[model samples]
Every structure is written in C-alpha cells, then in structure tokens.
Target: MEAFLAYTLVVAALCSYANSQLVPAIVTFGDSTVDVGNNDYLQTVFKANHPPYGQDFSNQEPTGRFCNGKLATDITAETLGFTTYAPAYLSPQASGKNLLVGANFASAGSGYDDSTAALSHVIPLSQQLQYFKEYQTKLASVAGSENASSIIKETLYLIGAGNSDFLQNYYINPFLNKHYTVDEYSSYLISIFSNFVKSLYGLGARRIGATSLAPTGCLPLARTIFGQHERGCVSSFNTDAQQFNKKINAAASQLQNQLPGLKIVIFDIFKPIYDLVANPKKYGFVEATKGCCGTGTVETTFVLCNQKSGTCSNATDLHHSKEASDHVSLKQFDVLRYQQAGRSRFLNDTDKAVNSHRLLNISKIPRRRNGYEHQENNSKFLQDGTMNIN
Candidate 1:
C-alpha cells in the first residue's frame, strides 16, 4: 500500500512537469478586440490611450486596451495557461522577456480589406499585419528561429477583426464598400480575409484559433444607431456576421489543406452570445443592451466610456485620465461581432448589477480592481495567493 501511494505521487509529479513544459507563448494580430495597445504608436485619433481602458486591467492604466477589464486576448491567453499577454508591438516598455511571451498587434477600427473603409484614427488591416511581421523579427532575434517557432506553435493566434470593415464601408462611410449587399458582403469579406490567414501561416503561425463574429445587431452601438435607441440587435449586421463565420469555416478548411502541420480553429462566439442573451440565467447576465458606464448614439465605448473624463468614471478612478473624445471609442465596430462587436464580449454590464445577486462565476486573478493588476507573475504560481486579483 505504501509503495502504491508513492508511485501515484510520482506519476502526479511527472504530469505536472510535462504540463509546465508544454505551455506555449502566443503572438496575436488583428483589431482592437485583441489589440493590447498598438494604437499608441499611431498618430490616429482611434486611440484608447487612457485610464478606464485598462483601469480594470491588471496594470490599471489604459494600456490602450479597449475593454472595461481584460481584452479577449487576455482572457484567452489566461485560459491557455500563458503567463499573460506580451505588450503591444509598439510599446517601448516591452522587453525581450515580454516579447517572448506574446505581443498584441491588433488596432482599434482595423479590418480585413486594405481599402475597405476609413476611420479617422484606426490602423488598417495591412499595417497591423506589418507590425506582426516586425514582432516575428524581434522574437527571432531574442529566442532564435527554433525557439521562436516553439513559442508560435503553442500560441493561439486570435483574429477578431472584420466588422470595422463593414462600419467603415457600409454604414457610416456611404461609399458602398466591398461591392456587395450585407449578404454578399459577408461572402466577399470571407474571400478577402482568407489571404490574411494564408499570410500568417506563411509567417510560421502554426496553431490558429480565430474568434468567429458574434451577433452584430445586438451591440450597444448597433442598438443605439439602428433603431433610434431601440433595444435588441441589428439583424442585418448580425446576419452579416453569421455569413462571415460561414466563410471563415470554409476558408479554414481550405487553409488546413494548404498548410502542413498547421491547424486553424474557430472560437464559436456567435450562438453562445445569442443564447446568453436569450437565456441570461444560463450565463448569469441581465441587461445586455446598455453599457455599464452610460449610453448614447455611440453607446458606451468611445469618449463617453472613458474611465477618466467621461460623464461617469468607472473603468478607473483616482488614476490618470483623459478628456472626452481623447479616448478613442473602441465601441464603434468592436461592439458585438467583435464580441463587444465591442470585442470584449465575455464581460458585460450585467456583471455590475446594483441589487441583483446574480453574477457570472469565474476563475482567475481578475485583471481589474479598484486598484489591481492581472497576470500570472509565473505560470507555476497559478492558484498561489499572489494571483488572486482582489
């Protein structure tokens, strides 16, 4: 009996050691939903460079993130056992150590088409990819080709951009972008975006788990704009997202064939989102329409949503801040399809119910606190006292 117990303990130790060795570092690309802070490098107005953006973040300063708390990349990285995301590709603060973990190249308001739409202060899809290339070179310098490939192999390449293309082309900018109606547009986007996947595969990205667009109509921004403040989703935009996913599924199928030892996976966020809204008890959410901070024509993502100078300060308080319009509204295209299309979908205002006891149960050191920073200082330290956010 004693020997058997000892053998079991030995087996457990091996499992732990093997699990530790397999943890991989991811390098992310795409738009604001996953953008750690790349917009900080650009001069455009599409900046989220303020307090509230990251107020709830582990660091507690707008790291140029576009969510009340963690970005999709943050949650996904955490789920995959990564220590934490590497800084934005443009952050001068990033070091060799940081880059090896992962780097976010997403920018607010970016999309698949190079010339799809025009946003005053957003990164174009092509430019975001350029930054990705730069990150690859930098990683290569630090970890060498083999080590870099190892990191890339373990990383989950999440691409959450697309709706911005529609916003820039179909909605706000009346240029009739993409040359298709909503239904046709989704198909066109899928075709155009396939090349992007191909490009990443060529760059040594082996494992890709893309976030399929969610219900676009359900975004706060769409609700505000589509029906003059009516609640619920923008069916047209939502349909567009559905169509986009169908294409993504098809494209991933083709890309899988072309690449060797490569995998393309989809994070199915659409049906889940709709189901969450339709049946809040299952997901522990209520009030899916209004944003926590406030609402308006632009909803709660742009200037009004800032944790600093916006009407009501929530994302941050007693921290550095900015003025209205100073913070780039990530609320635009990111609101729902992006999962926010606000892209930061997993989190919702329902979490802040004043009297409702209902809450979404979770695991982690939440990246946000009145003053808290989120990260696995070391992956091995997970579940240790230091990792508890509050």
Candidate 2:
C-alpha cells in the first residue's frame, strides 16, 4: 500500500505539471464504469452509495461508484491534476467552482440505447445530454460565458457506455432479439454512437476520448447466464461485443474525418480485459471469472452487493464479471494515464504494448489498489518500454 501511494504521488506530480499546460477540466459521460455517483441521486434500483460498495475507497465510504473504490473516470480526473473529484451533475456538490473542474453525467446501467437505461431506471444518454446542457448553463453562471466556453473546449471528455445495452437489454430481451440480429443491433448501436458524438461536438466538445466495449461475454454473469451449460465464457456474446467494437472504431474514424475540429480517440478496452480474463495468472489474478462481492456471479445494483452481502476481502480479484463488483483494477490506472497524456498515438502504441503482454513489475501491488500500482508501473513502462503515451 505504501508503494502504491508513493507511485500515485509521483504520477500525480507529473500529471499535475503536465496538466498545468494542457487540459483544464475533464467532463465524463457513460455507464457504471465511469459513473461516479450520479445513480445515487436518481430514484433507481441501480445505486452503489452504501456499505461494502466502497470498502477499499478512501476512508472506505460508499460514494455511489459501482466499484469498491474510484472508477476509471475518477482516477482519470485525478491524473489530469484535478485535486477535486468530479461531482455528479444532480448532486449538490456540482455547483459553483466545482463546475470548473467538471461533473459526471454517467449513471449505473445506462447505455447508448434509451430502453436499456429504462430497464434499470438509469439516466439515458439523451437525458444525460440534457444534463450536460444544464451543466453548461450552470457553468456559465459560475464562470463567465467566455470562460465556460473555454472550459468546454479544453475539457477532456471521457465517454464509456453500451455494456448494459447488451448485458441488461438486448441479450435478455427476446422481443428485441426477434426483431434484430446481432449484426443489425451492433450497427444500430453504432448509429447511436455516431449521433451521440455529433451531439457532443455540437455542444462545443473537442477533445473527446471514448472507450470501446470490453469483452462482455467473459463477464461472470455472462458465464452464468449464457455459459451455464459449459461453465465458460459465452463465445456468442463476446463475438457480438467484438463486432460492436469494430463498428464503433469504424464510426470513430469516419467521425474524425466528417466532424471538423473534433479530436476523437476510441480507446480499445477489449484486448486488455480479454487478456486479463484469458490469462489471469499472467496478470496475477487468481479469480477472473467472479467478483469479490457476495456470490460475485450476479450481484449488481441494489439487490446484490448490499451491506449484508459477503464481500471478498480484496476487491481487486474481480474481473470481466457482470456483477457491478467485477472490475479490472489495472484498467483504471492505464486508461487514466492514456487519457492524461492527451496524445492520439497513445492508443495505438498502448494497444500494441498490451497485446504483446509485456510485464511491468506490478505484482506487488494490492488487488483493490492495483489501479494506482499499474499507473505507477505504466509511467515507467510508457517511458522506456514498448508503450509510449507521450
């Protein structure tokens, strides 16, 4: 833990220095992966602002983040030199100078599709966009219109969504399955993604970093639901996810060409997550199939992972699982480092490095806090190893 904190401090110092000359704020939009605490403000079953949810977070207090600690977005914000964590748009903390740092519009269970969000009573992409507009008004009121515009233009917009679209909606809904095939559904999602990016561009966003879909089929819930017979990852679900990821990547390329002054980069999460799941031992993960919370198979939202639930002592063991508790700890640090670098070439370089499976001497890091450990190791790796974020 001491080594982890030391690494965090070092990276924080470096990022702080770099951020003084680069990004001024970070605005995030997405599902639970980046949703800080917006779901807590909503009257929905999808909330994590309770005991056992933040067992490893600072002070071990539940802060509405689905994970036991900070989400990738939270760590990204810190890496960008924002001492203050981004507040949820609906939370009282998202006012005054706090608006200058930015606010999180992500909600647990949200996706590109509105119906998917409706199932979990989460804030849909459209509603989140409306909230973004509201946030602009509030920002303008706090800072002058000119300054607000500057912040909007310079802010690093991090977006991560669409997981729930497959996990909680399409795959489970036989009605939708009857209407759309996997390919059709993936294309449909790409259309929504394209429109969402265009809308953000219309809102004065320029530096946008969107994450591609992870290996959802490898999730514990996927294994339980679709792989129950075989006791393995659902290949069909993973194939769909890969297809969706490809479409999103293609859309990102086209959007970059079509939208002028838009700097959009799609971060590839599939490879890193799939690598961790497929080779858990290589990454020092003993349990990649299940989460640390309760049964770790199906514990998500309010029903599962509650205060009474039995949580694993180490939150880091969770992996590509579907339970909200299932999270890849390494992702938080690596993704944050990539975003903080603010370089387009970083994605390609990092993808190659991750695919090559280069070890980073991070085995000593604790599971729950491995994000920081990876961040620390990533800094060194990026400097001298195959990965180069600069």
> Which runs in model 1 stand beyond 4 Å of their true positions?
1-23, 116-118, 177-179, 296-304, 307-390
Weakest ten-residue segment in model 1 by summed lDDT: 1-10
Q: Compared with the true structure, what per-residue lDDT tens digits does model 2 show for residues 149-188?
A: 9989877777778878898888988867776677877776
Instruction: Give the TM-score of each candidate.
Output: 0.69, 0.78
Listed per candidate, the RMSD to the true structure in angstroms reads 16.8, 13.1
At residue 43, give the lDDT of candidate 2. Answer: 82
The local distance difference test score of model 2 is 0.65
Best by lDDT: 2
What lDDT does model 1 reach? 0.53
lDDT of 1 by residue, 275-343 (tens): 644664543344445444544345344433654345344332111122211112222112223321221
Candidate 2 Cα deviation (angstroms), residue 362: 46
